[model samples]
Target: MKSILTKPSSRIYGATRQAPGSKSISNRILLLSSLTPTKTQLKDLLNSEDTNIMINATYAFGARVQRSQPEWSIHKLTLLTSKHSELFLGNSGTSARSLSAMLSCYQGNYFLYGLQRIHERPLQDMLFSLRTIGTNIKHLFRPSCLPLFIRPLATVKDSIRVLLDGSTSSQYITALLMVLPMYKRKLGKGITLLIHSIVTSKPYVTMTLLLLERLGMIVHRYGWKLFSTCIIANRYTGPSFCIEMDISSASYYLILGLVNRSNLKLLSICLYNVQGDFFLVCILKRMGCSILVSRSDVSIYKQARKLLPLRIACHSIPDVSMVLLIVTLITACSISLSGIRSWRLKETDRLLAMTMELRKLGVVVECGIDFISAYSLPTSHLNKDSTININTYGDHRIAMCFAVISSQGVNVRIMNHQCINKTFPSFYYVFNSLAG
Candidate 1:
């Protein structure tokens, strides 16, 4: 495995950078744009493996995608030319789940498969829901896993209702929200999604609903258990859309600025409630970090070396939890995160990966079924210039979070550092440029 060893910089200075486009928003918008026949230009789309998977998936489905780096024009294909096709989604939960659901609603036989890790992730919830909605689907490999086949609609009903468990992942909810409107348009019937439990990653589902509204789909909600979209003549339509900068991606820098005591400005960030990860600012405030938020930027600086401890539920911000773990070491404050049972279903077992890596730093870490608690050791206990080897496990978040540990005067050798290409391809470039 190729590894990159990052050492602590002797000096930290003020710097400004714009994070990559929001992966959540970018992928959501990409799938939504393809569902409609109207030609759309997506501005500031994230150029990463996952978004590229969505782009390729759409193109395979007949959308004419013309790429111009950050900007891509997509002309949605109006009809299906082939009856059978196979697609590969490389461990991208958003791409695999959402795209599979979208394909199920269409008239085709889709043999969806992906890398080994993608197969290991949970898909039973999504598969069960599709079967409930009268879609013909079969698990071609291990039962309730990926390497599945979705046949043409076996039956069309007057009212399509699928009972889905939201406790695992919200992409299931997002997938249904994006596809149901198209189902309504095609079947001349309303769609209802009955969420069986409290939705995990509720904020991500909110992101999807917001985008659905932008595409002219009005989804009526009955608390968290139910979402209904009344049948309408209007089809999905968005001529042009702009994706926001990735708030989750900016989280590494936010914690870095605090730990390194650097004056850093994150540009092109809109202080919006749409992305749950943007709540990191609130966490920073609780940590006693000096944070200034303007219209389009967030400036972070260290107020004090010692900081208050934190215990947060990570269900809404699972992707940010890895970075938050690093904060414990930098601040010498206890940080406990809960509601992260879904971590097991991600690219790798993040809960386990983080626990193992933290223990290597001599920090006391405890992990449970849905929680991880890290009690910090004093900064004096850390051996400065000591190199710690981090196995990235091919998970992007794991690699990026550990990279920031170098800011704390500890060197980190991150294996498979290129795992970041899954989301933030420019992570190391931006990280290196911020040092003086």
Candidate 2:
């Protein structure tokens, strides 16, 4: 259903709600489970399009997957036995990139394709790295983009090494990291990776490594330049695993409390979580939002005065930048955000998307290669219409961030509102519950 959210006449009081499991953790665990030769049970698995694709991809590789709400059972494939298969990943970069690397290291003939937007996303760095390790994979359409075909390698290499461009998506590195363990199991030697430049989204790579350690794998990092993994048990041993609540999804509600000056609580979300987006709370506090952290939940209460404008770099917290930008818009303050070069590679070109959309609301936004400065306009000059339409460009964050604007009493009509189903299917429901 299309959502046209209008601000409530009454103030939003304090409310508590639970977010879905972290998509990042759910997908990573799904990939790791497929490489094992035992039955694994995953609890609190995210039931979204992105993660469903990962589950189906694992099933195609001959693993058995069964779901019973909040829990899933995966039976490992005895061998990389799928001789031929076709996978259609719908705009899930995590599933496409990670599954491609896993399929390459196995004995199979596979075709990996995705939605048009996914094909536009870059995969060259990961593909090049896999090719260096002797995987017989080729890009069917563009050099770095998708529509890939993989043929079985005649012989698996004993060890692998490749240089990656770190400026692009960190998923490339994650894909490589997830697949290397398989090589170790087959050839009895580990793999080495050299990153040629400064890695953007370093926190995501750290998250990947932390998950690997939990599954009983060891990865060594020498500064940001190189990563090497030694042979451990190549397979993940799991009777059960639980995923954390999505910190990225929780940021929206936290911002709501900050903007409305009402008390907001996020259920089952912890402040000391592995998810990098958890740092958003610190950024919020720095901007003069009152926050309280406890063992059970995190709460944000609105401030009496206008929020302090911020000038910060957001390379590690890229996902939260859009929400922060929206904060700048509502308060009409000059905010400068830098270290966001990777925004261009997301589901849409977010920098361009934000600038174009904000201009429609009479906000002066300047975009650079790695920075954005938003100069707030006076309320008199701003469009005072009760209703405004926003184009979402099929990016979930764009859709959700703008939805928060509606809570301030403006009517916001979000075009392509279904894009939020990719990660947070219940976004609108949860948003309404809080705003009411």
Candidate 3:
């Protein structure tokens, strides 16, 4: 699991096994549990690197959590003493933002820091919204970014509304909602927050709403763009919330089923999900893959297609870009993907990394300041290098994305094989197991 991958000269010829609970869902549920005042139990929560870091950070931030067997219990914080405590956010952005927003709403002096790159990442938009609402947050470096110092606002008058930039991260909006519930429930007055923007990655916001509703709270969404709701402070008994298997994580395997032309049976695939990433199924169908969605599962198989010149706007489904990008690579076809501009701010500079890494395979990629378009031609260049060593850039998506390149039978070496730990720690094994 730790070695650099060496791609074979022939087809990787295999099937794929899937990972469990979505990391995105895991982080959101963790935040929900922390905000809920009563004991809420979480079931099927991801125990992966990122979610685990979130779990530890949650307890560190003063949320009492207990894990036993298949259920985990959470006791919310009445008062998270915020006195100059330096909180390490690790590499989990959801944990960092959601937790930071929570701490800001609480009365305290807290220094917010994260994994080195996380501190380097910007949080200004969210920070400014928090500060505007009168929470204590200071940027040691810039105005709207991370490496923040949050000093408690003693006289912050309990309620405020702010705007969120849709082009940026939806996490900012999610962070606002996460804090809004608490301020409404515990603090003096309930806040009515109105967010106006062309929201992207609209599924994530849906995930937040869905989880909140499951916790027995109410919230409203106007289409996928506007969210307005009041979370009444209630005695929450954290009932067992089963985490959904990651559809995004299953994408690579779905692609494998098509690419390998294998005879593996598809079972229990979730297609009708409020999770926005489910659109991946539509995108695949467009590309001429044979996919059937049954009541029990979804199956994807290969077919002959007039592979269109795909110009996809991926801003709504950032996490699935890896598989899409690789699919473009296989077709030797031209693909222009947009709406993914914010992908630059992901765990890695996704735009630049995707372009540079694909170029190593002798494919031509042209990336604009905000978009990336690539085209590969039919060529006999599979074994020119015999082994392609690609850097993961510390982003898990990049690592898994390139793993597909090996399907063509080219020995691809991944610089940091462990990066997949962010969402799917057992990705390599699960993938290779299909080879058996």
Candidate 4:
């Protein structure tokens, strides 16, 4: 479903509604659910591409995932009588890495594999730590990458410390913590997972802790980046839990306020969001877009200013690079963004994707290997309205971000809308609600 863009009115209004479930929380809970003896009923699991991958992977790992109408059930791995499992994590980094680290403790051979994207993603950090604890895990392909075969370790009698960046992806640290309790510490205490770098995207860690608590695991949160967890046997029980809204996916609509459309009050987003993408909402609004944030929703209305030029560091909010890059195209002038070196690791190199997509729009976007500067030239469309043909490089964010770029009175066609199935399946419909 390619989006046809047109300039929006000041009032892009709609009844505020709840978006889908948080991908981060859903994946983490699914991993934990498979490990605990509790019958976990996960509600509001995202009907997105990533979560669907997780759902299939849960069943592949030999867990009885009961699905009724909308919700799902993951019978605890502890309660399961089976000892053999081969897991297939489609392309989910969180699910693959977390499951790999946790399967190490089960003391059996469980092969975890995934698609090309997962094969391309880094798992060396997780492998190094797990191997330190005596897990017989090794990559089937090149070292530090995926297609890994896991053989059960004899026994882990030692605990280890791992230092990694929270900015890269909090899943690395959280993976260790989720499987940490099964390790042997020096004094017979629970496994100690320490983050040695200044953490970015701290909200994701918070989300992890929240789900851990819901599962009844005792996790102690010390400063911003520090957290410790121990295995409390019989903690995870199969019960209903609500998945939080996805602020990351919602940012596409939130950026509509920049188009000077409507003064909407009740947008379909929440205020206290644990997702890091929420900060982009505040940041875009701060740059002069009229944004109203409520307890369970956020409303985006246009501002008097045509557009505001912004310079933001994207190291912490790496996922928002698509939205931010789209904004750069709509600006009356150039905007500079820094700290984007991590784009190389995504399904596609997002940094390059943004540049290539911007070029399609006839914008002169100069991008170094680490940073990008895009200047929205005074185009005929800004004055006379032109149509935009958006080419999505099979990247979901590309498809989603182009929807935002389409709001400028230009009929935008996003080729390969199916690419959005990578993250948000409903992206076409949800984005159309805002595009209208």
Candidate 5:
């Protein structure tokens, strides 16, 4: 459906839902496994548009993939021909950035293009680092944008080093890191990465480092800024791996329960995940939501009479901040989230999209490059009787977060509702189930 209308509810109660696998871990593992000569079987990989893009890209790069429900076998071909190839990555930033770096290592003519919005996202910072290592790239349309041709030179450096500005996006750092073993094998030594400025998403980079460590690669660091991997494994060789549940997706339901004062239980909740968005639980607790966490389940219900006004930095939990912003509207409480400049670089310009939409709901919204604050406006400025139509701007998180308004006695119409396919394809099914 292009649009979905959710009817208002008095309250929601007694519901349970299973969280999806982590998209970050799933994509990283998909690429890492395809680089290994050994066969790697991944269990519980997220079945979504973003992961499917990675899967198709791996197959296009000559990796053999066998699909079995809940398990996928990926075997890297002994030889990947340096033939001409064209890859079309949807608006998945993870796929576009990481695949660009990985394809740069191969001596081939590869054409890369994506959807319209993806073309607007920044690729210049990552391309500059790749070009420093002698990777040939031609930007087709705009500078620092997508629709490009990449051809690596037919030479291998004996030793290599490059500098990256850490504040750009953690995905750029992760893109280079994931392709390090290939450089290590070709160069006969580990490549050194000199990072300048503060890393924007340190937790995500930590996730990359942890995954590299899982592949038995030894990354040595001088203090926190400089990183280099030991030439231990020329290729990854993990036989089988399980992906952790996505805490980002879980935040939607948890916040839904808090807004509706409902009894909701989330299944397969992992407390020890490397995903930084797990901090949502702590944020909810701080907001006075009654939450109970156990080995594999989390329960949320009514406890607090009201959600407290929150002022918090969103650098570590950028993905779920959309739902937190929605909480500001549902509870009619003030919320100010900072350190989210990266949102401007996501699938859509989230900072601008959010500000515009919040204003439509009679919220007094204020925003800059790095922060957004919202509070309910005066009663005279409110439109209390009409349904709110939320334009999602094709951002999956925006569509999902606005769906929660139904529980707050507001009818909500979500435009481009199918955009949730980018991450959680079954979101509406689950949301409707919980709404029953």
Candidate 6:
């Protein structure tokens, strides 16, 4: 599918929107809910390919899942019953890593795999940590990638020590944290995790701990390198909860308001939300956007002042880097983005993809191992063609970021526009509605 966004009108009024539920929070809550024995009522759940993969994986693990639009009722089993199962998680890294950790504690024969891209994603760090805890898991094809065969222990050891390579993905650490509480329950002792390198996406790990703490789980951290969690409670008392709107999704509209000098309000969002992408608001504010935060809403309006060039360390908030790069493009300001080496391991090589795509629009981008420097270029240097076709490489972020270029009255045709279904299926609809 190809999506064409005509240059929108300069001024947008009376634009108020709410994004879908946070995909990160939704999937984390889904996995946590499946560990409980009672029924969990989750409201404002994200209905997307990634979250759906998590839901299906939960069901495949013998949990009962029922959904009704923005709500879902999950009845979890005391223990997973399917001893022999094969799970195809598509390209969801969260599902593959989280479920791999959960399945490692059960006494069963399980196989986990995904699409070609998923196989290319890193899993060795997670697999190696699980192995330290006596999980009988092996890579079926390659050394570090997926198609893993898992045989969990019939009885867990007294204490397990895990040494993780923190440079790759924080999801590996979160996967262990999510399942370790159960392991602690079975062993009557806590699990210790040691980080051998500086962890990326640390805010994501913090979000995981926050959710676990909300569910009455105990987590202890020593500096940024070490973490330990013990099981204080064996059974989870399932509770009814509502998820916040996705801040990452809200970012596009934020950018829309900033560049277009329009007023925009995002409903069902809070200033104290757990998402690391919430930092985007502060970034925009620093870039000279006027933002107001209320209890349940955030309003952004364009400022008359110039947007100052920024040098930001985005290790904890890598997901927003794509949109931020677009921000630099529209502002025609030199910006330095650092601490994003893990961007290479995402749905695509985002660094490379962004560099390639931005050059097509006559932007100068220099990419390093873990940094990106975007030099200011006049929009006049853009291709003289009526429309620029952007290849998305099946990455949802790539599709969404280029779509923002349309706000500058530059027509963009995003190839593989359907990739947005992975997270925000209504992205274009929302964009069109607000762009008017």
What lDDT tens digits, residue by residue, belong to model 2 across residues 1-436?
A: 4755544423577888888899999999888887667888998899998888888888766687898875888887656546899999999988888988888877778999989999999888788888888889888988867899988865656556778998777888888888887777766766788999888888899999988887778889899899988645646676578888898888888888877767888877776677888888888888888888887698888778777889988988888878888877677777889999888888999999999998888788999999999976543354446568899999999999988876766677898899999999999877877666
TM-score of each: 0.96, 0.95, 0.91, 0.87, 0.95, 0.95
Write down the RMSD of all candidates, one decimal each.
1.6, 2.0, 2.7, 3.4, 2.0, 1.8
Residue 44 of candidate 2: its Cα lDDT? 87
- TM-score order, best first, reads 1, 6, 5, 2, 3, 4
User: What TM-score should be assigned to candidate 6?
Assistant: 0.95
Please report the TM-score between candidate 4 and the true structure: 0.87
Clashes of each: 0, 1, 14, 13, 0, 0
Strongest candidate by TM-score: 1
lDDT of each: 0.83, 0.82, 0.71, 0.67, 0.83, 0.85
Displacement of residue 192 (Cα, Å) in model 1 is 1.4
Worst 10 residues of 5 by lDDT: 377-386
lDDT of 6 by residue, 361-427 (tens): 8778999999998975755556545788898988998999988887766778888899899999999
- lDDT of candidate 1 at residue 180, scale 0 to 100: 79
Give me the runs in candidate 2 sitting further than 4 Å from their true place.
Answer: 1-10, 154-159, 378-385
Per-residue alpha-carbon lDDT of candidate 1 for residues 31-56, written as tens digits (9 for 90 to 100): 77876778889888899999999888
Candidate 4: which stretches are off by over 4 Å? 1-18, 60-62, 77-83, 163-167, 184-189, 221-227, 231-234, 263-268, 382-389, 434-436
Question: Alpha carbon lDDT of residue 261, candidate 3?
Answer: 63
Candidates 5 and 6 compared by lDDT, better number? 6
Checking candidate 6 for backbone clashes, the offending pairs are none
Clashing pairs in 2: 261-302
lDDT, candidate 3, 22-121, per-residue tens: 7787888786777556667776677788888777766645587677877677777754533557767777788778878878866667777767668767
Q: Give the per-residue Cα lDDT of candidate 3 at 100.
A: 81
RMSD of 1: 1.6
